[model samples]
Target chain A: MEYVVQTTNLSKRFGKESAVIGLDMKIRKGEIYGFLGPNGAGKTTTIRMLLGLMKASSGTIQIFEKDLNKEKINILKRVGSLVENPSYYPHLTAYENLEALRKILGVPKTRIHEVLEIVRLTEVANKKVKGFSLGMKQRLGIAASLLNSPELLILDEPTNGLDPSGIIEIRNLIKQLPAETGMTILISSHLLTEIDQMATTVGIVTKGKMIYQDSIESLRMYAQQKVLLKVSDSEQAWRSLLGNGIKADWEDGIILLSEHSDGKVAKAIHTLVHEGYSIYRVEEEKRSLEDIFLQMTTREKVI
Target chain B: MIGKLLRADFLKIKRKGLWFLSFLGPFGVIALQMVNYGVRKDYLLNQSDDDWGYFLEYVHSFTPLALVLGIAILTSFMASIENETNAWKQLISLPVSKMSVYLSKFMVLGSLLFVSSLLLGVFSLGYGILLNLGDQIPYLELLKYSFYPYLAALPILALQLWIASVSQNQGIPITTGVLGVIFAYSAFILPDWMIWKWPSLMNEWDEPLINVMLGIGVGTLLYIVGMLDFTRRDVK
Candidate 1:
């Protein structure tokens, strides 16, 4: 697979504190690679290093197959980014704000209007950004990022502080970019649900370490529901089910079954009851994606 | 790329009253003379045989202080325009090199000061003509007095910009500027080598051109040093 962005052991240290350590991120072309991490997980630091805004203490960053150190300007020509807060002149109108960047990008002036339209800021194009709500300012940031028609777009918490409708608007816009224009996007957010909704591939970082990096579907697999049984002599019941070729695990006082299909569950219960074990209760343990995400981030371990 | 960045920077500073400040700096210097001549026209006219020369001296007296304070405010304002929105990260992230960004800022501030110098020359000429100082206007001396301080003040401009750009707090640059103004005010006693003293165009050797030469040379040196530091540091 062709990768649009690849970093090898990228690390950054401030004094004795290491912000990002040994991060190998591979983002394929035309994929929405969600950079997931909680607050203070070095997401902004990593993105800054990639954009050449901040220097890495050690390691290499290659964007569009070009060494970031040597070809930063050339690489950044095709890369657009909005880091942390939405940066703007605030005193300038929305149209003027994008126009400022448009001048640097050397794109046609009409491109400004096009990006404004895409972010749905065309109507308020002449309004000063100081009066804009957080959502509007964020949309303007997105508009500025799209000014150059970049092939790779990096946005750190783009939907932050936006209302629900605004969040959906940005989410849909990000989701469509890859399909419509073949642009590769790397969006970082602390919310797992946000990444789960948009990212095709996910790289989860916690405390500056990449613990989980895979497809969103594979991440969802970790959230698969299981069957938990409360039974008298649960240890013996679990062993009895296992001996009968019904695979299950016993933890604390509960019998946990990974394969929780209706037939498999019924068979396990029948075996436990037939073995003279009285079942107190049988319950389906549903693991939400949020729970799995918290476990992965808090445990700080690769799954 | 530098041209484009300059254009973008100019666009960003719109409605920020930077143009007004540029116009005001020189106009304020001349206005001080207006009051000085207005209150005691007869008394001042008898002070020198060359009336226009005498008037130019009065104008030159305030030029250094105004130039230093103006550099401080202008450079600070220029930096705050970007710092206000934390746009430094966004700007550095653009395709343009960081060196070019620093150069563009220096050029913008330089252009503003250049315009202020030009206006100072015009305002002094207009007032000298209105006062009927003399048929022999001593245009060269008027030009020298109006523009010499600006040229000699370049080092301060460069230093102020350096401080303002690197400092996260505007107060640091403003405080430095206040100290510079005080030094400019006491230029008679200050040693000739000081950057703030250079703006007064005063030296023990009694040659104004030397200060201008030193200003250009030291200004270029300070600019390079500031640009190097600016490009080396991380944006955040």
Candidate 2:
């Protein structure tokens, strides 16, 4: 139960707007922790705080068992980061960009070649980044982050601006990092689907608050999967479905039993059809990360 | 770590292509003298010792002005290079203290400009030597003449570095630096005895006695303040 990063009551304020409010987070060692929330939900702000890029308006941050504010240099020596868009000198070659970062981090030159290989940028390493596509630039950024062989890596929207294939490549790369190097990763994105495949644990935030945090498997079981019901008699069917100990919500005349399985839904549907209801539709709907994310945040926004 | 930072700073400074201005400054001084010497070639050769001395003094006077402008432009460009590259974010994230980060660039730009001014002084002195007037002109005396004014101009160099470090927009630092030089020039117009004040000392151009003490005090004050302001201020 060793946590690589822990933030207790961390909050940040920009004049009047509270970008992050009382955010308490825990990211265990060797785990890929996904931070999922909508735009402006404080995901980037939290990451900035953790990296010591921005100071917290209040609260404590601990990185690898060291107090972040007090031991920032020592803590940062073991952590690497890419927050927001990857910034580099457009005129510099990919190798030059990494070289500059290597110098600042005081990493050995050999590590530069190793990271370029890791990010699969060895072929284009000598090419100026100005001509590189967004995906190539992103890979170069990831390569720079890995130059120090850090114990923890924090990335904000790491796959952003990449094509589908590029996304898959980065996803696979992120998936392999922990297994191969024993690095803990904190990936923040507004898109849950992006993190669903890689992250071991997920923290779902809405309106700057952590609404849910759990293992990915538990989150899938308790929050994501839905028992979708397409029933006959679209009007009275809803009433009877609700009446017969079936708790369901309406969407385009399809009843949604959230976080439920097929057998539970089947029993409810059979009861409705047995009661002389003209059942036109009945099928179990598979919920996606997008669906879960939309449901959680939309509900929070409404409240 | 500081050495790494210095290398990165040098790479960035060299990439901006600003060293051309340093060459341009001394070259401009020689060019102007060449044109003037050509226009008055016959009259300048027939002049008396006092008149030749006046021409030599004019060359010496104009050289410092060109040198100051060079220092101002070079300083502004180097300090603002960080804003252009977004290098401040990356550089500041390093384990070093923020003061060293700001001062290192300041020192680099200051040293480059100081060297350029020294070169321009020698170049201007050589231009004077070429006039070939009938008087015994002391070559070593002329070199010492150029060095003296450079010492006095050291405070102006510190002032430019301060402006450059705190300003993000290149225009602001350059504008402030130009105006500062103008102010220093006006201060030097007063009698020499009345010129030991900070602004006046910036243009006091020949008293080694006054130059060394005021140069140390003013340069140290500006460097300390500039570093403090930079390290303490937030980077946008």
Candidate 3:
């Protein structure tokens, strides 16, 4: 019941278009809260408002029980964030960058070496950031954010522009923080697969409105199941199945049969095979976060 | 405490090498003047007290030019580095007060510019000594002259810092700084009524430290506005 972050009726507007609408959300302590959305879905905009980087057009934000605007310095002291690209002074060494951050935060010098070890940048700590790869910069950014051993860590697409192994490393690093130190994390990413592995709770926002917010278990339990069937001719199969009282959603030669029973699938397949409809594949489909997200967000588009 | 904030600000300045340029800038100017003196050695040597007066006059004239270049480059670049590296996003997110963050940067840049002017005064005295121009060498007098002229630069430094912090773009801050210097020079030609209290144009090199006090007043006002502007700004 102790929410680490809460935004009530939060909104942001640029000229006429509302980048983020009336969004109400809550994130509890010691949890990996995943914010999933498509590109241009206002994920970054909301993060910026929450971090006090930008003013909200309307409504309020509360972090760690402190009002964001009223207690900015207090809230920020307990919060660490990596927004957009990981940036640092390219001429300064990795250690130097961390040192600069530590000085700004008034943290002890010992914390610099501790964070460097945490990010696994000890060997290259003295090397200038100019020659560092994309992953190295991200790790350094992460190290800088952890300088104060913050209670809340907000990461916006931290795994973006990383190699496969780098992505896994960052993912594992994020997963370990909550258990190891009890730091509540808010991670935003466009890819559901990325959040699926780590997040304890997930919030799916599309076009600034939070459409779904629940734990992974609840999402899976409440999520609609569908049978996926791939046919030789998706358009023809859909047409044939429609005549037999079977509703099929066709996408790229695959018929996604939602809101349909297994008996309904059997009858449709029987009619398709007899009518010389080439059946390539048919399987009971497991609904991923992507499927649930698409169903939730794309429903409006269909209407 | 202000000391911790000042230390943090100074560390940033040291890391960025702003202090080095403060030393290097005035040194470069003295080197250029020495080279100029070398080319006209025969004309400069056979001179009386009146001639020494004329040479001293040239020292007075050239010192402001040196201060101009030093302050402009130092103020513009130092203020923009935080923006160029997106460092402010990380910096202001710390436990430090927003006002402290703004003041820290302004204080460090102001401190460096003052140090540069002090070096120029010492170098000018040395330039006179090396030339054997006895009357031209007003070592104690030159030291006295440096304070007010450096103070006169305070308002300009404050304004340039304001421009740099608000814009968050390298070219705009530096370009605005160069234009501000030009405006200051032009204002000097205007009548007393038309001439606003543009500190850089005051030229208090030979005047009392009173002008420096006045410059501090105007500069403090500009610095306050700059700090407020930063606190209200929306960071990208």
Candidate 4:
């Protein structure tokens, strides 16, 4: 895979406490990589290290296959980032704010208007940012990140403090970038649902460590629903199902079936009916991604 | 890159009142003299055989204090512009090197102080002509007095920028600046090695040129140290 961003054993320490420890992040080209963690999970710290805003205590970061320490300026040329809070000069107008960065990026003045229109701030382009709402400021930050037409964009909590509609707008925007422009994105958020909706690749971190890194589908596999059977004489039914080579678990007077395919569930039901057990109820119980995310982060176990 | 950064920085400070402060520092220094000459024109004129020299001396006395306080406020204001929004992280993330960012800030502040000094020279000469402090205008002396304090104050400018850039709290630099104004006010009693005393252009050798040379050399050294320190740390 052609990775847009890769890190090896990245770590950062402030005095005796480690903020980020042994993080190996791989962000592939043209994929929205979701960096998911709870608050204070060192998401911002790792993003800072990636952007060269903060030095890593120990590790190597390679962007575009070049060493970050030696080629930071060159690497950053193709990368755009918005870390932590949205950074802006409230005194400057929205156009002026992007113009300030556009000057540094050396992009055309027309590019500024394009990004403003992308963020839907064209009407307020001439107004000072101090009076802007949180969502407007966030859109401005996103607009600034896109000013360079970067190949790789990193945003920390991009939807933070936005209303539901605004969140959906940003989420759709992020989802479209990889397809529309072939841009690789690394978006960090504390909400698992947000990541679930946007990221193709997911990396879960908690307390300075990455516990889960894989495709979003694999993470969802952990959240797959299971078949639950409630029947009279459940103990006998469980043994009977076990003797038939079905993997099952009996807990609290209920039979739990992990292999919950339609054929397996139908066969189990048929077998239970044949064994003369009265089937009272059969239902599927779902494990949401939030549960899996909470378990992974709180347990600090690699999956 | 430095040029672009400078242009962007100049744009950032447009409504910040920095330009007014730059113009005001020199005008206030000359305005103090206006009040002095306005009150006792005849009495002050009788005190010195070199009337123009005496007027320039009185003007020079307040120059160091005004320069020191001005440097404090201006440098702090420049730093707060970035620190206000925590824009350092965003700025450092740019393709430009952190060294260039520091250099741009130093250059901007340096340019502002230079303009203020130029205005002081002009204002002093205009008021001197109005006072009729003799036909021998002492143009060289006027130039020396107006520009020397600014040159001698370079080290203080560099030191304040260093402190203001690194400090998260504006109060720290402001407090240091207050102490600096005190030192400049009592310049005669201060030791020669003090950065604050350099602005007064005083030393045991009694050569204003010595202070100018020390300001340039030490100012450059302090600037390098500050830039190195700024680039070494994390943006937050």
Q: How would the candidate models be sorted by lDDT, starting from the highest?
A: 4, 1, 3, 2
Candidate 2 Cα outliers beyond 4 Å, as residue runs: A224-287, A298-303, B41-56, B128-168, B181-212
What stretches of model 1 exceed 4 Å from their correct place?
A229-256, A271-283
What TM-score, over all chains together, does every model reach?
Answer: 0.95, 0.81, 0.83, 0.94
Please give, as one word, the docking class of candidate 1. Answer: high
lDDT tens per residue, model 3, A183-273: 9999999988898899999988988898888897777665567778888778988898888877888887788887567678788889889
Q: True contacts preserved, each candidate?
A: 0.86, 0.27, 0.53, 0.80
What's the TM-score of candidate 1 when only chain A is evaluated?
A: 0.90
Per-residue lDDT of model 1, residues B77-178, tens digit only: 899989998999888999999999999999999999888988989999999999999899888997898788988998899899999999998999999999
| Clash pairs (backbone) in predicted model 3 | none
Model 3 ranges off by over 4 Å: A222-287, A298-303, B14-17, B39-56, B135-140, B184-213
Which of the two candidates, 3 or 4, achieves a greater TM-score against the reference?
4
**Chain B alone: TM-score in each candidate?**
0.98, 0.80, 0.82, 0.98
lDDT agreement with native, every candidate = 0.92, 0.74, 0.78, 0.93
**lDDT by residue (tens digit), candidate 4, A156-210:** 9999999999999999999988899999999999999999999999999899998
Grade the docking of candidate 3. Answer: acceptable
Candidate 4: where are CA atoms >4 Å away? A228-264, A272-284
Worst 10 residues of 3 chain A by lDDT: A294-303
